[model samples]
Target: MKVPGTINSRNPNSQSVFENSFVKTLSIAVLMGIFLVDMGLGLFEIFSTKESPLPTAVVLLIFAVIFIAGMVFYEKQGLDTLSSLVGGALAGFGFSFVFVSLVGGVQFALGGGISTIGWDQVISAVAASMIASVVILKALSYKLQNHLY
Candidate 1:
């Protein structure tokens, strides 16, 4: 069994750098997709003048719950590490969405009516979540490779 490395080089599929990187890259892409879709819905609610922050909060909460269920299901496939990254990203997006839609709405609810949920915040949150997920999962995956396989 190989010891853990900074990056995941523990692809049980093949003992090659290319194979391990491919698996990690694919997993990262999946997590990114999940985050983008969830956050996009949150953004839609945030921008809708009639809906208010409540809808965005509800949507994010729903996503958080669903994400947990998804992880549980994926875990059985021996894909827990990949699943965890997706879960973390969903959480980050959910929190950022709620924070921007609710707390930032003070100005809008009061009158001057400024949108608190800017594209910048959404983009930054997505990037931050994706980056963190990759780092955390790569480290943990390398560590758990022996035990998992």
Candidate 2:
């Protein structure tokens, strides 16, 4: 027997869970797409098709690590929305600058260096990082508010 206004659904929680998962997946893919396109355009001068695949892979790996680490740090720090976004931007800029600088330095020391990575790379990386963070946060926020309200 069931109350008229209190019917039970065997999978009552299923809808919210599925929706959350879908939103997370979609947001992540969008972030990744933007990051890849920006990286490709930014690095074209530094890496030609012949020598690209490896550096591109390495750079993206670093970005992924930074992205995850930044998210964890922001969550742990309990940063507000804007603070988290700014922190991400700063972290991304510093990480990109340092990573590329060291790489450029090594190549220079080896006497085969043809170019360097600089401000544009850092700016793009930072912007992409912040954008990704905000996107995830915004998606989660809406989902949470929907459930709560």
Candidate 3:
């Protein structure tokens, strides 16, 4: 049996230099900061526009690219299940927020006004995205652990 605090026994050879808890936490925090800033900029772009969808489209693209890059980095580094899950969840949550904001912006521009959008809608979207992301990550982790990936 493997020790609780030790590395995974199945992939004992897959250790990375960033296996330390502090480094992992710090890295995640930094990624979160980036996400928050990007999200803020996207929101600002949304509110500052009533004539073009280009800005929201660009924000959506950037969010997708950043999230994809982060996931790819984790995959290449062979990070543990927790790391992958947390990374996916963060990226998914951020993307969901940005996407929802973009939709709201479009609606506002199209005369839906602000009454149709509320914190409840945004929270629900984020929560649903978080749940879906966790489920997906868990399944992928299981597949990878079983060498089915």
Candidate 4:
């Protein structure tokens, strides 16, 4: 007999601990932390070196790895592709915006007076984030689906 308010360990339909929403949220939070660290470090590198290509490449590589890992994690949890895509995009945009603002604030503190932030820059960051999210989600979903079966 199943006890009230308690999960049945023998129940085949019962989800594992990792399949719970709490785990999902925790995983996403971890991914976001990774994203922020990667972005902050990448920005520091670019600013310190005054060279763009190498830093950009390194950042993209880090992003790609995280995206794939996130997608795989979500897939294992039975999350749909659309949800993953939207979640990834939102996380990316939010982090990117914060990163940009933080960089601007640091610059202001370092003798560069506060300047108006252009809407174009914000829009571009959002657009780039969304594009990257979509591409990563779609490609990973396809690969995961085929590999799982």
Better of 2 and 3 by TM-score: 2
Cα lDDT tens digits for candidate 4, 1-149:
77766865367787988889767655554554445443544465446556552345554655555566666666677889987766655555554445554544344334333123444553455455545655675688789999865
Predictions: Cα RMSD each: 13.8, 16.7, 14.3, 13.6
User: By TM-score, highest first, what's the ranking?
Assistant: 2, 1, 4, 3
- Each model's lDDT comes to 0.60, 0.59, 0.59, 0.55
State the displacement of the C-alpha of residue 105, model 3, in Å, after optimal TM-score superposition: 6.9
Worst 10 residues of 4 by lDDT: 108-117
Q: Which ten residues in a row have the lowest lDDT in candidate 3?
A: 32-41
lDDT of 1 by residue, 1-149 (tens): 55677365565665765458778676675677445534454455457654555556666776676667666756666676777668656665665555555443443434433235555665665666777667777788889986855
lDDT of 3: 0.59
Give me the displacement of residue 55 in model 2, in angstroms.
Answer: 1.6
lDDT of 2 by residue, 1-149 (tens): 76555657355545664378768666665666455434444355245433432366677777767766776688679998777766776676568645664554344434433225455664566567657766777788898988954
Backbone clash pairs in model 4 (N, Cα, C under 3 Å; residues 3+ apart or in different chains), count = 0
- The alpha-carbon deviation from the true structure for residue 72 of candidate 3, after best TM-score superposition, in angstroms, is 16
Greater lDDT among 1 and 4 belongs to 1
Best by TM-score: 2
Model 3 reaches what TM-score against the true structure?
0.30
- As for TM-score, the candidate ahead, 2 or 4, is 2
Sequence-dependent TM-score of model 2: 0.35
